[model samples]
Target: MVTIAIIGRPNVGKSTLFNRLVGKRLALVDDRPGVTRDRRSGEASLMDLEFEIIDTAGLEITGAETLEGRMRAQTEIAIAAADCVLFMVDVKVGLTPQDLDFAELCRRTAAKVILVANKAEARGAESGVLDAYSLGLGEPIGISAEHGMGMAELRDALVEALGEEAFADPLAEDEPEWWEEEAPELVAEGDEGEEAEAPPYDDTKPLRIAIVGRPNAGKSTLINRFLGEDRMLTGPEAGITRDSISVEWDWRGRKIRMFDTAGLRRKARIQEKLEKLSVADALRAIKYAEIVVIVFDVTIPFERQDMSIVDLIVREGRAPVIAFNKWDLIEDRQPVLAELREKTERLLPQARGVKAVTVSGETGEGIDRLMKAIVETHEVWNRRISTAKLNQWLSRTIGHHPPPAVAGRRVNIKYMTQVKSRPPTFMISTSRPEALGTSYTRYLINGLRESFGLFGVPIRLGLRKTDNPFAPKRKRPS
Candidate 1:
């Protein structure tokens, strides 16, 4: 895929446009100039084209021999590596000398340039839009990056510049030409399709696990113990992690892909827009993960925000394993563990029977047990129940305590079926879905967790109202 870079003077809405195009807040945006100091890369697809887009720090050459010089050097490096350069300019501010200097730099680089005149929503931007032409670059595409204007033109320009063949829609056509041709006989048709092969399932693929928690909770230290090296930078400072980093390795011959995310803090503390963007990126990593290990500091385990994070993970339908790190620091380990379990159970009642492990990131104590818990949780996450077995369990569960009456009418849960796994989701065909109380839903979810051996995995029980077609339609009295 082509690599595109957005380079411009600071405060030009380049980061805003980057977030908009990437369909996520991968890049930080702030009203303050020079908020973006690093070159952040993200994958973006415009229409039919997919490319890696890098959002670079705004270019400024002040003090020819200082730190500013180093910053300018980084911007130049990003420009050199880009396949196409998006020269962003603030239309409201008009064409400044800094903008012209950057435009001249782009011209010298000879990179394919798409001049974007941002903040075009304001009145009287036409003169500045026209002034952009004097830069000797091609016509400027007037846009309001903040308000999401002129995206189609931008997409068209990118496709045209990147080559139209690269932007062809993959789903526009049906089957490929090869599929229409006659299939060659492989040991004749009556081979029983190689003994009726079972549905393809990959057991060897590396388990994608994400270790997440608040900063200074020994997350980095735990990762070091697991990898047997100081792979991630760990210090006493909070918010040391500024980006989501992934490390791939094997544990007991089982391939694992582990992602270490920046500690998530309350919104008020995350005043810096860059930190906010980093937190959002961490949440994205959580969503993509198959299993999530929520590491918590032993002293402050099950804090309100920590529980909120766990709730977010469960709500996202990902299996969670609670790991209380820094056990070596706890003075009374046994009582503390018991109290921690009780607090976790009370706080996160949604994740009933969830696995919790205690380990010391410093000494590597209980690391093997933690791994075993992860494997068990993963098995539960991928567990499936047969239709008959589910129906059997459903009968017994409802028989024990039937759904309560709503509006003086009995609410009947007619049937239950497993819709999907990887955090099992079940659909219960019912008469009145809206009437089902939260307690009843919890009851069913707990029942599934217990009967189906779905420990430590989030279970979703959906109430789906099924229309009764057998009942005769009431004829209107004429």
Candidate 2:
């Protein structure tokens, strides 16, 4: 697919156009300049054209050491990689010196530049749109990115710039069609006569992983290391990342879609509306991600906010892997590692046996191990136990430590079956479900975790009263 990069000065509606093209609010948008720091991409469709659209940081002229300069470097990189560039300018504000400087940049760098005069719906924007021709980038496409105007003309311009052949689906010729492939056969039973588990997870499917933690926990730093580039805007500053930027890349031939979310701060500390929105985006990432890497600063590991994030992940039923980031910063490795292990088990008992990896985001240490752990944890999260195996285990467990009697009447555990996997959930029928205490449930859950190797991932256990066949059914009033 053709790759198009949107570039311009800050607050020129570059992100707005990106969100419009992607048909979703993937990038963070605000009236404030330079809200977007990192370059984000999404699959976009405009009429018949299908392409990959990149949302870049607003171009600014600054020194290489400055944050704005780093952002500009990313945009320049995007411009180089892109087949076409959409040079957006706020027509309402008219073309400024900054716009002119970037226009010269687009002409010099991008192969095909499309001048997009945004906010065209506003009054007096027509004169500003007309003034855009001074940059010498051909007739400007005047459209309101916020109002979704002039998309058809923009599509035409794109087709004209990059031949229509560029829009053709590359997969048609390069890869086998998904629908043409043979369907997988379902197995009813296993070799030992146990119930058949769900088919193995599709390796071809991209694994969705989200990196989350409190502010300045090295979430973005870790992801940058993974990509082997400064893909995310990272620094010593806390909360530099405000949007849940997702990047799709192959890790050891396995497709991985990793989301770098904003650092989550306590509610009282998040006084600004923008911060609130950023936190909300992070929470959304946690819910959608199949596996979540809760990053921790090695120096201040497992703070109150960190534990709260862990609790949130468990409650959301996401498979979690703990990453002790900034390991290079630690002076004594052995003692810190041992202490972290002890604290992990004691403080995060809910997610008992959670996999923890010590890593340095700055030096790219332990990344391979972390990725391997994530994959393994995902397998465990999606693991399903056969009904026969569950029943056998239940029987032995009950025999060893039966449920305590409720009102002198023993609560009988009847049957157990796995309803689903993906954070494996089970339904248990009992003679007195209400009478069964939380302690017994916890015991059963722990047993399941240990027995099935469901460490770290959340396991759901629900109780239902057994239906008595001998009991007469209530007659319907007809």
Candidate 3:
């Protein structure tokens, strides 16, 4: 794909424009200048064109005596790799020397340049937009990226400069249409006469998993042990794993893709630009994983941050299993395990009956058990409950503990169906979904998890009020 890099000075709405073009908030946006420190790349489409768009660090030619020089180096690297450059200038500030310098740099690279004068929604910036012509780059496109103005003109400019044939709009929605068309091809070989064969589980396919935890946890060490080498540099340094590193390997005849994420610190400690990017990357990895194994240090297994991470995994509807790493360092095992179980129940009541396996990565003890837990969790993650069995369970559970009376009227939860699997989401149609309280939702979710043996896998319970289609619409009085 053609790579287009957005290069400019700080606080020129480059990140905002990046988010608008990509249709996702992959890059962080803040009022402060220089919020984006790292280069973030995403596939973007304009009209019929598809290409890779990179949001680069703001250009600042600080002398080689400071950290700003290092950041500038990173930006230069991105510019070198770009097929085209979107040279953004702030019309509000108008024609700074930095913009001119960056424009010169783009010219030297011999890459296609599209000069954009951002923050041009107000009438005051028209002269600045005109002034951008003197930079020797062609007429600058006046755009208010934050307000999403002038997108059509910007699209035309991109197509004209980059060639219209280079662009193609990517298939819309989360799932592509080609996947539906190719469903028959994805069927298993032996199941020709079956209604529709499920996709075969390829052992060669990477088993994507994330290792997540709080700062100072043994996440890095556990990852190193899993790989049987010091693949990731580890030390007494906390939060050393800054970015989520994808390490591929074959584990016991199964191809595994492990993401060693950075230690997620509290929001207060995440003031640094690099740390913020690291956290965002880790969250992205968690969302992309098939299974998430939260690695906590045995000494302090269920800290607030650790529980928060687990809660996030469950909320995202991903299969999660807790791994107590550094177990060899723990002095008291039984009491600690008992307390940990109790805390897990209290803190993660949503993930009731989730499995927590104790393992010492340093000694390789209990590694087999951890692997077994992972396979079992994977099975539950992919499990689909039959409609008949689900409704039966729902009926029995509601019968045992009925929903509370709402304002002298009793609410009725009619039918339940497994909407989707891969964390096993269920949709329940009810007479009054809005009246269902948090306590009641927990009761149903717990019952579903316990009855369906969905331990260690996140179970989602969605409540929807069934609309009465047969009921006549109210007629307006003439």
Candidate with maximal lDDT? 2
**TM-score of each candidate structure, all chains considered together:** 0.61, 0.93, 0.58
Write one digit per residue (lDDT tens) for candidate 1, span 1-478: 6789998998999889888878877665677887665466776876667777878777887974554454566677778888899999998999889988888899899468999989888899998899888887889999988889998889888977878875555565555522122332222223322323223344565688888998889887798899997666566767766666666789877788778888988777788767877788789889878889999888887787798889889999888998999999888778887898888788888787889999999999989999989888888777666556777788988889999998799898877766666767777889999998999898888777777677777887778788789988999999
Task: Candidate 1: give the clashing pairs.
Answer: none
lDDT of 3 by residue, 356-418 (tens): 889887788877888778877888887776667777888888888999999999988887776
lDDT of 1 at 88: 94
lDDT of 2 at 9: 95
Ranking by TM-score: 2, 1, 3
Candidate 2 lDDT, 323-419, residue by residue in tens: 9999998987898889999999999988898999999998999999999899889889878787889999999999999999977999999888887
Taken over the whole model, the C-alpha lDDT of each candidate is: 0.79, 0.88, 0.78
Number of clashes found in candidate 1: 0
Which residue runs of candidate 1 sit more than 4 Å off their true CA positions? 1-203, 471-478
- Clashes (N, CA, C under 3 Å) per candidate: 0, 0, 6
As for TM-score, the candidate ahead, 1 or 2, is: 2
